[model samples]
Target: MNRHRFSTEEISIFRRSLLAWYDIHKRKLPWRDWHDIDTNIVAYRVLVSELMLQQTQVATVIRYYETWMKQWPNIKSLAEASEDDILKCWAGIIIDSIFYWSYFFHLGLGYYNRARNLYKCAQLIINEYNGEFPNELETMINRLPGVGRYTAGAVSSIAFNQANPILDGNVIRVLSRMRCIGSDLKKKSTTDFLWSLATDVVCPERPGDFNQSLMELGATVCTPQKPKCNECPVQNQCLAYQQQKEIESILDIEQCSANCSFCLKSSDVDTNRSLVEHYPRKKSKTKQREETSFILIIYRLTPKLEFLMIKQKQSNLLSGLWSFLEISSSKNHLDQMNEQKRKTYIIEEIQQMPTIDTIPSINNIKLAGQCRHLFSHIDKQYIIYYTHCEQNDVLIPSTSMQWFNEEQVQTSAISTAMKKVFNVALPQIKLKTSNGKKNGTIDNYFKKKNSKV
Candidate 1:
């Protein structure tokens, strides 16, 4: 799987130009060097940020990263933290950022496995590595849970200045266009070839700066839609840009090799998009599966205003996060069931809750609200149903299933779906105190709802 060898002269020029651009243009990310002299701390920081930034956008990841570092700060702190703590920290905690509390955009950050994996990695670092992060890739870094080649490469090169290669989405776009690769990117052959190219061109001496530069170049300049070719520092090195300039003649294109099978042919050019955009052939997206579920907010009004919340046992979807009792069903099944049947189903589901010592008779079940939430591969419809216990009944609490008052619900680390449900459901709770009077002003409830972290 050898790529066309890049000469030392060409590699040197690429490295120099790319690094210069990065120094001037790289985004001021929080996980970047914090003037920390210890390379271990720097490596730990990079690993955490990479894990968080995997499925979420940078804007969303920034606040979470800041909150995480502030709480854990180091490898030992993260390892010492409980699984619940890790999950809660991984979920959005905005007590610190009161400035954004009024209008914080709540992104699900759903892949709960990433958070669990982060916790596992931290424990491994402590128990196995004596609280020190393993610097070498093969030594222990890549072996860490949820760490792949790309993440390992990033940590190694960026933190230890190791001569490793990284190929993220941005870098893939940049390299595919640079080499004018037009094959199906979803295919293994194209991916392997791109990895080979990435390995070949990585700067040996300043690998850290070089990798960051390439990523920055792709992120800011060589963007997917309309690449700023005129402003690209390495436009001279990009074959697709040269192709777009009508320098397709083999002699004129400096980067083009002699009839290479790896490069896109002239016939591959898409008229709809320019030549550079054509290189990285866009992969067709798979349609998201439709999911329909009933999120039952089983509550009580006797002792105080409290709602029952069940901790999710499923790891694949919102794993270990707290939400109301959920009953999943097919859309057709849900449609066929009438309102009375749905309540019967809810009653039956409540009876089966593992921790319930006594299944309280539901007083009045009503449709509070409904909302749609999108996961990575599922479009979920939440039919929010809320009900309370009879006048003399109360819900017994357990480790997995606990009760939360309004203030606690506002502060707890519930799933984003549950939070969305609360936005609609809680206001209609008829917030009555034990003495059967309106607890607080409705305006305060609205204010508290708006400030949910």
Candidate 2:
């Protein structure tokens, strides 16, 4: 019945001794270079790594990071690349995409495009701060786009050799095991306690090395699983070790997951239990839904054979994106002529707009290929329909409507669903205007109506 706890004085000694151990045994990583901090390369690396590490492992990021760096070394290069190309770089990491991580790619792109903002922060360092990375954590944290307090401390101490304490999951684990902290690390009180302990233990002069050393020790020696107590530099001073005869024997007293407070399987009674194998069961799948969509591709040749693109603003899901007019239905009964009860449905759906009653001025209509896009919350099955319109009289221009050439459309931040739409519609457009093929159907109708008037 031995409890592991350390006094404030002993914690300071642990910090200094662990830092000395880190001086001898720290592993070299790509982002640790002294000269790279001032450049965007390190910033980009840190951003991408942080993004990639969300719900993913460090071992998985190595090859992907290397390949991405080799292909697009800088932010400008990444911005110039296609979404498909970026997705290729993110080939293996798709399974790791939870809600927050799904937005990582977007955040990365946002920051990359806004590199001038980053330079605003970086240039000030070279010019005003004299090429030295900022030592004060809060100042550096305020400049970056997405960096929070913990991340700021990590970068400041590790990159700038500042006297800042890092309180990541690894450090929390070390402190929790040493003190036998029963509270969950996610709780605010637990976090505050751990941060205070981390501050108490950090060696001031080489705080960066000291912090990294603690993390490195937790990652390698004081691991969540069978910790190599013999290899630990400060094993003699550790309260957990001094109370119990040996690390292995102490760990054996409880389940493997119970000893490590950060273990995913940790519970209130016994925190450490090897539940890694059982984690997949938490995410069980149910029956998938079937959905259908009708996408309209209307074309007018006034501005170099451009198609009508609508900016969907009604819903936040597809808001402000240039897409075709779309309708989602439960069944594929679009071709069935609606002579009865169709008007009521149309009136209800298009409550504000009454212009949809007169066949919608659709010219020659062609059925394009179907596409399927799967989302976490919803499933979509798209059937594309293209209509050719060489006549200018019927074309309407509003804030939502845009006519862009193929080159212009290609460079935009279009969704993957729209990309699939373009793949099928482009060839259909070429077919309509292959040999002076005009939109005669709609033109003839307009001419006849004008004669009647």
Candidate 3:
């Protein structure tokens, strides 16, 4: 890899000029402004926004950040809110793998816990330090959870008046371009060198401002592509400028603005004419799977409307997701009961079969819905049937089953498939007494509920 070394004097000149340029051209952002900032609130916002920004674009983070801030204005509020609500906010963003989404939720829970720590830190500030954020970077960083070096540096340099160096994408880009370093930026040694350089150049008195300025220059004038040499304050000192290399034409300024990197590639007509046009391709074929099963469970409920939901004992793919118990046919039962007989048996068992006959209190058994939930790896078609009794029904479904309402179901940590099942199945079982005229089915219940509300 090609590498360039900078003399101590050259580094000093660059740092000083960049800081000067930042003073004049720093971009205005909401988080950086201290006026009217509730330190704890801003800290929480910063933490959430930063977490969401990982492997995601700034534009995508903006609306989500605002939505979350609006919903849970404080750490306590966020912690108290349902994970489902939070996950719903992250709906389209989640990769849809039950495992990934589950892990992501827990990861966010860590952040929420960190927010609580920030709250505690804030309380300390109000009680002891008179509401001022600690000026020391180490002190502040030590108080937050999951706040590693980069985040700590970002917060300290941007939020508090601390001189901490940040090694982020913009800084990496600027460093790569300025020093003409060709070593992969992803390599640890290259990153460490950049961090050392960043630390060495950070101005203590205006550490935060100077650091932000470096980022600003990298983001704007000394951008990843088509750096505006005429507008750049330190163009005279730039090695790329002095070398008079083809670096300036490395990126097409217009194409770069439109997120068209391929378009930026210089194409000479003669060499490329024989190739096919790049874009359209036929869709790949998907395999069709055939699965048959009888999802069996007796839905017994208490008179007061608490429906049973069971958690699985075995850790299957949708291990943590909820569903009624399924009874798989042994080879003999399946062989003996032909397809039609099997279907009839399933309906009868779901509607009338009770492991326990009478609830200790008033409870009834009923049919819910028959539907299917499709997952990427498996398709779960459920023959969901429901039965109900009063709140104090005869039996609570052993340790596996707990009663939950529709609203509660929304917040439960269930699989996307289970969520789909709940959305479809919940409306089928109605609690109210009808004139026996299909009085209160799930659809009608929802319609009436919506209209009344």
Candidate 4:
């Protein structure tokens, strides 16, 4: 592979072509609005856009971004808003596969924490910087919660007009193909090299446009599968193109560290293909860990139907969010328990609850269908159970427990996992109610039973 650096003339040509192409083809995104160039406004817009775009598609973020800007136009406003409101705004923006991507970055830290950090970050900026977003790279990184190298660089360069480098997935793809970087993109060495190259090529005069152009090029022309090589502005300077043309002659072979399937060059004609297709190789990703848990959808009728939900402690995962009563087991424990054992375990755990004695007989508990929730690193299987009792038999609400009707549950600060569980239980409840039995009748019967007792 050609590892030579671009000449000064070549670099200028690449920049000129890229910028010209971007001028005509650049996506007119809400955050990229050039009408409001005020530094403070620009910084806030860039920061919010960056956070929203994490593992999210541009189309998906546009609506959310516009809505968010309308609702919380400034950092102070966002800081003043409750966490539940912010999270509810963030709900649908996270697409299915992208959730996994976010999970990978956050690992132990759930995506809800991102919302929490964004809140804290806004508060910090308001308190320390007097509500003005910091322009300096180090200041932004040090002050903002969850603001790392990429986010800091992006905000500094795009909003503040500072000459900084950014290396998001799109930028990485563009760089890897441009230089024919065969090393695993996940390696620290490869990342450092790419950052250095990005810094080197960034236009000093218009660093924001330069960086954004590279990213836009990757997003539009140089896509991962079936790249538009003919339409790429920087194709003339791309070493991958040159390598693809000459791969037929170079006999000496080296195994690709990325283990990519596309660029395998062999002496056999059948195996020979363009090496350009595999320029930006990547190591295989680890499989998602599978886990099993039991979610209890307990309800009570006291003239009105209310479902049981638990508020997660502020310190654990999904902190501050409410979810259904769940008995979760790690993969190891799941392996130890057979299907029957798992069912029994769930029942025993529910029976052991302090408030269990207050509820009527558990004989009527019905096993609802299972639900599958995919996180970044975990594939969770949730077995749902539905049960209800008379209002007088229901336990009193505690700090961590609450009873909510359907509408309340819809608006409550509930996790997506719990929402899935609710979705599963809703149909079951609807089916039961659809058959002759009326909610009002059930409620009156339970109320009369309580009064008589």
Candidate 5:
């Protein structure tokens, strides 16, 4: 790996400039309120903020963070809280944008696995560490279920004031541009090299502020697109800026290398301002795999209406979360089946289940149209089917399955995918009752329940 070496004076200038800029321009976030606070409380706050900020934007996390602190306040309180309550707290942060015509939200708060992991993490800390967060990075990573390298480093440096290096996405972008590293970020070798650069430049005296300054600079000034290079405090020490200046100094620009030595990519460099934005070239994203599932929104018209929901197994993708009964087409031997055969296959599979002995006639079942829910690497297509069964015909569910009334389903720890399924299927189910299609009863239920958030 080709490395950029800075002189002692250059490194000193870089650190001083960045720290000075950070002191003046840092965003006033809830997690950064470290003044007059205990070390344990600081550690807990940092842990929670880091976990919440994973793959979520800062603007989205701020209100959620504030609400969480008010509710839980500390690790002990969080540990004592129920998983359902924690999920409710998380729901406060989730942004649900409903399109006019579609029942599915554009983005759902689909972090069910992370929420479960957080519950287990809080329990682990309370039981193992006596309600105190671990200070050592190694212990934090080893003992905590979901604390990865970046999170561990952030907590150790920010909360404990330890001289640790963090390589989050923001820090990676900052370091890559500052040092003119043009390697593919998806490669492990490139990531290791960036971590080395992070370690090399981290200030020993104020490790917390110094590390955060780099990340802040990336988020505020050194952005992914159209970065404000002229306003950057450490522009003097930036290798990418220097390379851009060199290209701009050329008399015959066409004679210069189309692929410059810094980024090793073709570029005109006609505008020095835009050159810095091109250094951290990212690799193309991998295509998401397509998956199809048959979701059964089985309901009974008892004295009060009740829906059948199943708890996801520990071995499943959304472990410990409750969702509608889903039969993946892959497992049902319907990969090659036609549309009619697929529906038939789903009905046959549901009939075979021991817990559900009798269901309504096929003519009475209604298809509530298809809805999509996206995971990190899977594009899930759900064929929602609504069926009504008699109360006497519906057998008592085993330990894995439970019958939930409208109120229970509304307040349960169900995934956003299941929520979408419910939102689409419930209206059709209501049409069979006295309430007409335009009554908006299901919408009222979700609004009344989730409105507190």
Candidate 6:
């Protein structure tokens, strides 16, 4: 049995109130500013923005979105871009999201999924759909690489003006409050209930605006922290607000048919509880598993200054970008390795490298220091080290290992964590000053020496 039902009149009021609020208060975003509403053009822009936004904040994606639009401009252009180029742009140093990190000395983050999916989506649209976004949500959901139900509904309603339903975090929050649902959001049952409500209230005449309004209301007014109920245009329709006021028994609301299976019990709503902030309940935070990464910034001084880089196996690529050779283990394991053990481990790892034709005697390598990079789930420590070839050893490059001079490393599409490693290392790899003093930087050495590959 349906727990809640909105009448024709009630749905009408929701549309009018929500659209009026959205028209006046929607954030000034680039995707919303298109002057000409060509269906293909709108779909392309919407697809890129929506893909970039997955698991990311709007404030963080704006610049990347702008740059991406200018660079590609259309589906055909994006379809032609290489995987490396797509990954480079999509990750854009992976600035938008922090969700790709993990622990337990296992599995590369699925950070590459978004980049790979979006790339495949554009190509499919170009090759299969004749360079235009499909007009129907079913086609998109079924055929497009990364277009899931939420993305499909968004593209359908916004680009094609279809009355397809959508659900994202903001929508989930807003609807949960409006309906006063107090169930665990992580559960699938709660999500199905919300999706039903979304399908019900979305006005066919203005589905895009209506859906955007729900998200806008959730983001700006019905926020997770401290919702501004006093300013909410739909506060009259919101069950949570009414419950807070004790204005009327919730069961008596004119539109609802059955008692919600998920509503908070009356006794659970303490009189001491504050305003409308108690609508949608939040689950407790998961305890994050912690780990540390031991990184090596292996370098060579032959011919000129250069850093050795591993062609990183797919399992180890961070954010799906190549990294220098490194190891991951628990902090306890790292702590147990004494100075001599650490030195021995570094030497053996180098000796195993196929790139070095003749590594010098064991004394050339030295510990450079430490740096840290924070990910959403993992707390990582980069234990840095450096070594130099004997200035005359012939270095052989492999498909799995190669040496890059400072400039090449700087210009390469390195991951954000890798960039931090370079920053920690540059100052530590001391350079010789003109007076034969060892007080300069490798950053300067590259500029003067014109280092070879």
* Model number with the top lDDT: 1
Could you give candidate 1's per-residue lDDT for residues 1-453 as a string of tens digits? 223334666667778888888888889999875785588888888888888777666777788998899989998999898899887776553323332343244334435678888888889989998988888888754569988899899999989989999999999998888767766787898899889889988988888888888888888889999999999998877767867787645333334456565666554444567777765776764356789888788777645678888778876488788888888879888888998898788777767867565657664688887998887667899988887666466555677888888888888988777788887887677643322343266666656657885
Q: Which residues of candidate 6, in runs, are more than 4 Å off?
A: 1-3, 96-107, 247-260, 266-275, 285-453
Cα RMSD, each candidate: 21.7, 20.4, 22.5, 20.6, 22.0, 21.1
Q: What is the lDDT of residue 77 in candidate 6?
A: 87
Inter-residue clash pairs, candidate 1: none
- Cα deviation of 309 in candidate 1 (Å)? 71
Model 3 TM-score, all chains together: 0.43
- lDDT tens readout by residue for model 6, 93-205: 36444543431221246566877887888889888888878888888989888789999998889888999889998898888777778767878888898898899999899
TM-score of 6: 0.57
Off by over 4 Å in 2: 1-9, 33-48, 71-88, 95-136, 140-143, 246-453
* Pairs clashing within candidate 6: 91-94
Global lDDT scores for all candidate models: 0.77, 0.60, 0.55, 0.76, 0.76, 0.74
Candidate of highest TM-score: 6
Clashing pairs in 2: 257-271, 257-272, 257-273, 258-271, 258-272, 258-273, 266-271
lDDT of 4 by residue, 2-44 (tens): 2434677877888899999999999999999867568887778
Model 1: per-residue Cα lDDT at residue 291:
97
Question: What is candidate 5's lDDT per residue for 108-218, written digit by digit as tens?
Answer: 434555666777878888999888888999998888888888888898999888989999878988887787766567778778878887887888899999999999999
Candidate 2 lDDT by residue in tens digits, 213-258: 8888878887766677778888767544554554343334333344
The per-candidate count of clashes, in order, stands at: 0, 7, 22, 0, 0, 1
Q: What range of 10 consecutive residues in model 3 has the weakest lDDT sum? A: 273-282
Candidate 3 residue-wise lDDT, 377-407, digit = tens: 3455654544444333345456556666656
**184 Cα displacement, candidate 4 (Å):** 1.8
Candidate 4 regions with alpha-carbon error over 4 angstroms: 1-4, 95-109, 249-273, 285-453
Better-scoring candidate (lDDT), 2 or 4: 4
lDDT of 2: 0.60
Those runs of model 1 whose alpha carbons end farther than 4 Å from true positions after fitting are: 1-5, 93-110, 247-260, 265-268, 285-453
